[model samples]
Target chain A: MSPVVLWVGGLMLAAAAIIIVVRIERGPSMLDRTIALDMLVGVVIAALALWSAAAERTDLVNVLVVLSLVGFVGSVTLARFVAVEPEDEGRILTPEEVRAHDGRMRASLAKESKRRVGGREDAMRRAYPESEDPR
Target chain B: MSVLDWFASICFFLGCALNLIAAIGALRFPDLLSRMHAATKPQVLGLMLVMAGLAASLGSSQLTWKLTIVVLFQFMTAPVSAHMVGRSGYRTGKVREDLLVIDELTEDLDRAKSTPIPPSSS
Candidate 1:
């Protein structure tokens, strides 16, 4: 391959890698991130192939083989364990938003505990209404 | 430049173009399944083309076999990974139902849920 061809191919591959990184950052779900990551691996493989072809290096072929085999494992493992995410949970939270959410959760938990402790008879009646006196 | 070098150069360019296209699709597609369509198909084909170009440029039987192994592994694994991701995406409600025209998997899942399994005979 000529030097010009190599340069152009390298540029294109770089652009693809950049776009894939953006997708990875902006992906709304774990699976989306996984898919972008898988594509990143493909881009890396293509870049390595281009380099090997340009340099006529046979040593790098082993790296290509290993990458191809290992790339799928990350996506497969992620898919196996990925659960349903709430609407806002998929996106990254700001520090303030995280604090607010924690506060809301803690407030609800405190209220529940207070209710249970202060009104044991009411809690029991609610839990076992049928067993309570009808009158 | 000889015919073989020209062939390799063209292959390399086309493969890079395909990678660019796949990246564009992954960025612009509306949903996860569609992005997956972008990620797997063109990406795999582009890798194969790049490998072909590599093999052509090297012009050795030994290196050619190694390149072929890389392509073969990619071919075998891409679909399996895509299927797993798509299935899990669908199960987790990441797929946009309005965009689907067929949806047999959901129908089958519902049927399976409603029907009780028969007892096994000893």
Candidate 2:
């Protein structure tokens, strides 16, 4: 490959990488981030392919294979285990919003713990109705 | 430059162009599924073209086989990952229902939820 072709391809790929990074930063959801990250991996692979072709470096080919597999595993794993996120949780929160969310979460946690404590005896009785309680 | 060099150059340029397009789509698309469409389709095709160009330029049997392996792995994994991402995105409500023309998955999920599953034989 000529140096001119190499430079043009490199510049194009760099622009793509920058755009992908912006998407990764501004994505409103985890799934969007995952998708953008996947595209970023594709761009990286293309860049590596370009470099390998330009330099006739066979060693870099293995890196391409490993990157593709790793990207697939990463995105699939994230998709598989990701939970539903609240609309507001994806972006950065203001300090006030964070404080309010923290207070709300603490209240909910306290309420849940109280409910669990109150129900523990009933739960134990239900589980061992035929026998006297060991305690 | 020889004919092979020209062919490689064209393939490389087209692949780079496709990558740029995929990036733009990923940045500009409205929702997760559309972004996924951009992320997978053009990206994979562009990768294939780049690999083809790599093979053409190298013109070595050993390195060509390695490039073929990379493309094959890409072909095999892109759809599986895309499917997983899309399914999870739909389930997690990242997809815009209004944007869909026909949502068979939603309909099927609703039906599945309403109906009782048959008891399995151990």
Candidate 3:
């Protein structure tokens, strides 16, 4: 490959790597981070291919194989870890679900308050019958 | 420039571009499953393109065979890994259910839990 092509490919791949790193740094969830890391390994493989092509070292193909294997294992392990942890599931609620939950809580609170107020009025009427008489 | 060099250069650049796009998708996607989809789908194509570019430039038969093995290995593993990650993400609640238009897994789990298991012959 020409030096110009190699340099351009390398630069593009490097830029891609930077974007993936940003994702890893700021991903909102652990799974998102894991996905980013998996992509990093992929980008690394491409970079390694570019390097081997530029450097005329075919043995890096072996490294590429190993990296792919390692990446698969890592992703599978992370997935397994996340799968078994049920408590973490449902950590993110959608806007509609959140709103509905909030509404349900408010309604329950209102019902409880209404019950309390009605009981208090009943007690007052029983304690002072004349107070309840219409003036 | 030779035809081979042009082909190699074009494939290499396109592959790199795909990688960049995949990265953008991974970063900007709203949830884990979408991010996983973004990270894996284009990445396989990118890897193939990049490898094809490199293999085109190599002179020896041995190096070309090695590249073939790498591509095969990548294709075999990428989907399996992505599937595992998506399943785990779904199970662990990394996915936002409200965003999903259809939830087959939840329905399956519900049906399984509601039914009684048959006695094993063993």
Candidate 4:
């Protein structure tokens, strides 16, 4: 009914968005990121609801329902994928095999990290030659 | 807005804030099961409150009915989804038990295998 309400709602939604952003930045795994993003979507839906209330239109509620359904379905699929694995962790690989596999995985991750940093530095250097690389 | 409307909005705000708190708990918790719980319990109820508040404030019979449906469907499905995710994570060795208070699903796995329970086959 007033500008104050609008401002307050917007600020609340912004705060929620900031939480989602922080979660995205610090999430330790893909699933964690996905969950955080799902929370972000929920915040968006809440914001949408408030806007629809402000505008006095009911049509958007249907859109909200549709968006929520789609989000839920997509998230459930991801959760399922995360959930599915054969029920044993005690495979009979030899110690040497395990060590070799671990070594390869670490090497690949390191290479990929380096490649990412290198790409960033190249772009930054092209943008400003005098700037120190942030990576 | 009426005092009733304000009350509804405050309830909704509280629910949403709790849901956000749940998300924070999920993030700060040390294990997957606790996180799954934090994501599920508060959020499902929180969204229900949001739907309820909207329904109350709308003043339209049609809109209210639809909002009821949304709340109902979300209430029904949220737990099913959470359970599936938890079960799948457990099956795949994604479980972290150090933070868990119980393991009701521990026996379920053996029973599931003994009965040859295939995914989505039931």
Give the winner by DockQ: 1
Candidate 4 lDDT, B3-119, residue by residue in tens:
857855665566557656765676677666666666765456767777766776677888988877766666666666666666666666666767567777776656776885544
- Which model is ahead, 2 or 3, in terms of TM-score? 2
lDDT tens readout by residue for model 2, A11-128: 9999999999999889799888888888888888989989998888889989998987777888899999989998878986889998999999999999999999779977888888
Model 3 regions more than 4 Å off? A83-135, B116-122
lDDT per residue (tens digit) for residues B32-110 in model 2: 8888888876557898889889989988988888888888888888888898898888878888988889989778777
Between which residue pairs do clashes occur in model 3? A89-B92
Q: After superposition, how far is residue B24 of candidate 3 from its true place, in Å?
A: 0.4
Model 1 lDDT tens row, B77-119: 8888999999899889998988989989778777777779833
Per-residue C-alpha lDDT of model 3 across residues B1-122, encoded as one tens digit per residue:
79987888898888888888899888888888888778875557888888888888766788888877887887888888888888777776666888999989788777777779833423
TM-score of each: 0.82, 0.81, 0.75, 0.67
Q: lDDT score, residue A107, model 1?
A: 100
DockQ of each candidate's interface versus the true one?
0.63, 0.62, 0.47, 0.22
Candidate 3 lDDT, tens digit per residue, A31-97? 7777788888888988988888888888888898788766788877877776444443425667998
lDDT of 1 by residue, A1-135 (tens): 899889999999899999999998887999999999999999899899899988888899999999998889999999999999888788888899999999999999999999887688776778789885523
Look at candidate 4 and tell me the lDDT of residue B24: 68
Q: Which has the higher DockQ value, candidate number 1 or candidate number 3?
A: 1
Which ranges of candidate 4 are over 4 A from the true structure? A1-5, A83-135, B102-104, B107-122
Better-scoring candidate (lDDT), 2 or 4: 2
Assess each prediction's global lDDT (C-alpha) against the native: 0.89, 0.86, 0.80, 0.67
Where in model 2 is the C-alpha error above 4 Å?
A93-135, B116-122
